[model samples]
Every structure is written in C-alpha cells, then in structure tokens.
Target: MSKPIRKAVFPVAGLGTRFLPATKAVPKEMLTVVDRPVIQYIVDEASAAGIEHFIFVTGRNKAVIEDHFDIAYELEATLKSRNKTAELELLSRYQPPAGQTSFTRQQLPLGLGHAVWCARDIVGNEPFAVLLPDMIMKAETGCLAQMMQVYAETGGNVIAVEECDPALAHQYGIVGVGESKGADAFAITSMVEKPPKGTAPSNRFISGRYILQPEIFDHLSRHEKGAGGEIQLTDAMIRLMADQPFWGTRFNGETYDCGSKIGFLAANVAFGLDRPELNADFRKEIARLLG
Candidate 1:
C-alpha cells in the first residue's frame, strides 16, 4: 500500500493586503468564519484526513497564528476548574498533539513557492500537502479528506480542482485534462496559472489544495517567476506534470475566499446560516438585505 499521507503544510505567510485594516492587527488566518478561525477549520480538515504532522510556513507578525494552535494554559485551567467538560473538549480539538505541530519562518514575501520551500527541511522527502489558509471549504465531507482519499487510491500528485466558468478561468491555474479516471477525478496533461481568457486550455481551475511530491522542490528551486513576477507553485507543478502523473479531484465543497473582505463576510454569513441558533436571525437579515 502507498505510504499514508501524514504531513501537511499550511502557507499562511501572506500579508493579506486585500483584507486591509482588519488584517492590520490580525493575521488573516486568525480571522473568524462564523465562530471558528479560518486556520482552525483547515486544521480540523487535515486532522480528519489523518494528517499527523502539521507544518506552518509563516512570517513576521504571524505569532498569533502559532499561538492559536498552542494550548491556552490559563484558559484550560479555568475551564477545568469550572468543570465545563463540553466546552473544554471542544476547545481541545484545536490543540494539536504535542510535537505534532511545527512552525518554520518564511522570512520573505517572495511568493507561494518560497513559502513552501521554507518548509522543505521539516517536510523532508515525503509527499506533503499544501493547504492555503485563506480558502475555507465547507462540504458534506472535508475537501482535504476527499482529496486524500483520491491520493491514496491514485498514488500520484493530486490537486483539488473545481470546474469553473471559462470567463473566470483566468483567476486561477487552469488544468487541461487527458482522460477521465472516474466520477470526480481526471488526469491532468497541462496547466497554466491565470492564462489570458480565451487562451486557457480548459476550465478545470486549480484550487488551493495540493498533494505534492517532494520532488517538486527541484522544479520550484529552478523555476523562474511566472504570472506575477513571483515564483508560482503552479509553474513547478506544470513541470512536474511533464514527468509524472497529476490528478485533479473536482472538489466537492463550498469554498470561501476569505482573502477578500467581501468573501470573508460572505463566509461568516454562510456559516452563521448553518448554526441552529443563528439560522432564523441570519435568514431574516438576508431577506431584509434582498428586500
């Protein structure tokens, strides 16, 4: 059997300039979607997918992100004193097992490639995952868990993909398909990051989740800047596709791009609507807005 995917890398080093003043004080990953922090949702998904080692590629002023995963000693103590077992158990899920979490400094704003490269030492030569914290996915099953199922069965580089409208293809890396594997997965032949509208090969756009082989480090190391004069992970993945197999799992999830203010607010509203206590109030507010 293929070795189980045990490690995951979270690229949370972005400045999150798009979120502006709100991000000035808080790391975007710490921003809440309803009640849970954005990064926590991704962590829960990874944990659910059986990922044991969690690595964070972070930068300056990102201490809050690290602290969020750490055990809050005083808070836990208070909860224990009060015997609020239910509340305490819920909070404990956020605290990763000791020694299972590791953090590395990206130290630069080079790009996603550099941020991912920063974690190579910790990742070693194992196939590791990269999950962008800005994208929060809500689905019947977690997106990462869904992709992990595909990776174990297929044993190749796998990415979470979603078929998007052709006009919106330029907003993401578009993947070209070779053949249909099954219901929700496809073999990728080529991919381009934000190619000009009509020039895009296909509408299967790359999302934030990637199950990348360690060999990608070689391609990323030698890769020149693409798209935005920054070394893009897609560029390296494109090169990796030439040699090995790359599968795209048409993601089954409602993804929220919390990198933008509008998307972030929308995620909060969407999540609120799912809450039993807030659903009625949220629906009323939404109706008022429409009216």
Candidate 2:
C-alpha cells in the first residue's frame, strides 16, 4: 500500500557564494522574499502539503535559520502589550509544535545527496520529501503538496520537473519517458544530471521538490561520487529507478533559482508583488528605477 508522506527534508547546507557580502554573515535561506525568509515559504509549503515533521540539514552561519522558526519572546510580548493580534498570529505560524521541527548539520560542502544523508535518522524508513530551499516556486497549492497527491496514486518515487529548452537540458537532470503516470506527467524511465552536449534523454528537468521512497537510502548508502567528485543525489536516484518506479510531475508555476543572486532578486520582487502591504509602492519604485 502507498503510505502518506509525513516528513520532508530541506537541504540548506550550501554557502550562498552567489549572494556573497550579504550571505557572508547571513544564511541564504534566511534571506527574506516578502517579509518572510526563503526557508519560511518552503516550510509553509510543506506544512500546507500535510507534512507532519520538518527536518532541516544546515551548515555554519545558519543559526539564524533556527532563530527564525523560534518565537521571539520579547517581540511577542511587545506585540501582545500593544494588542497587535494579527501581527502576532503571523509570527506564531512560523513556530512548529515542540519536537515537530528538527535540524542536523552537514559539515562538508558535499553534494545534495550528502546533505540529505545528514537527515536520515530523522526520516527513518519511510517515504519522505526533499526540497532544495534555493528553488522557490510560487504556487497556491505548493509544489510539494501537488507532488503528494500524485504520489498517493503513483505509489513510488515522485519529483517535480519542468520542461527546459532542448539546448539547455544539459543544465539539469533530464528524464526519459516511460508511461503516462498522469494526464500530462511522465513516468521516468531514466534521469541523468547535466548530460553532455546533445545527449539528454528528454527536455524535462528535475525541479527542487521530490517525494522519495525509503529504498533510496540503500542506493545512497553505497553511492559513489559523480558529476563533481561528490556524492550526487541524482546518481543515487538514477539507481533507484532500476529497482523502484520513479515519476516526475510538472506543476503550474514559475520557479526562481534563488541559489543565484539574479533569481533571488527576482523572487523577492515577485513575492513583493503578491504582498498587499508592498505591491503598490514596490511596483512604483521598480518602475521609476527602470525609467
């Protein structure tokens, strides 16, 4: 029987070199998109997707991430005194119940698989979702939540993938076609991360969200280095396809690669447009700047 996905892993270990100077002291995941940090949106997405436990894989300079999820005692007290209930409730939503949130550290700048491996104990032997905090998707249902619905039927590994330009397929983990898992989604026959020039199996690339079965742990345990002399998650995931069914679902949303400075700024601007408090003024300012 297909089990529910109760846990999610947020791989937040990378040093945001692309966002230097600003990221030098602050964790990139903690960088605000629109009054909320990038990580907050990811967690909120997972929560909306019915995730019961949130596991974060962090690195140095990321204590702020922990602080972000915790209640600001002084701030809450002040807001309470001022009778700012709306603002207070907004802050409270960020906190998970006691023991609901957990964190582990990835000491080295290893590959994505290594970051996920750091959280294995928390995940145990169950199906879990992994989301890279760098890829921000603006969706009403949230990408992970949508993937969960697909997982309930596919009953195997599922990932969020989007179509990229044929020439740019080498920049992502492209997938091969199998069967139609959904009306539009494709069951993955194979996947290769950043294939050589003109060698990709398909134009669909792995987006940042994934719901994987526990069998992946076995593949990852014996996984060797690939693509960057680091244990790439894509490599292990590829092996997983051999033994288990793997499928990728395409969602309706624009994904900003906040791993890069340009993408980060784009997300900030896009999110601001969705905020009632900032949209009007921010758009005016942006328009004036462009002029």
Candidate 1's displacement at residue 254, Å, is 1.1
RMSD to the hidden true structure, all candidates: 1.5, 1.3
* Candidate number of the best TM-score: 2
What is the lDDT, from 0 to 100, of the residue 254 in candidate 1?
92
lDDT (10s digit) by residue, model 1, range 5-109: 889999999998887788898988998888889999889888888899999999999999888888889999999999999989988867888999999998778
lDDT by candidate, in order shown: 0.88, 0.88
The residue ranges of model 2 lying beyond 4 angstroms of the native Cα positions read: none
Q: Estimate each model's TM-score.
A: 0.95, 0.96
Per residue, candidate 2 scores C-alpha lDDT tens digits across 1-291 of 798899999999898888888899998898888778888888998999999999999898888888888778999999999999999988877789888889999999878988888888899999999998988888877898888888878789998999999999988888897789657467898888899989999999998999998888887787578888998899988888888998889977889988887898899888889989888999899999999
Q: What stretches of model 1 exceed 4 Å from their correct place?
A: 288-291
Clash count list over all predictions: 0, 0
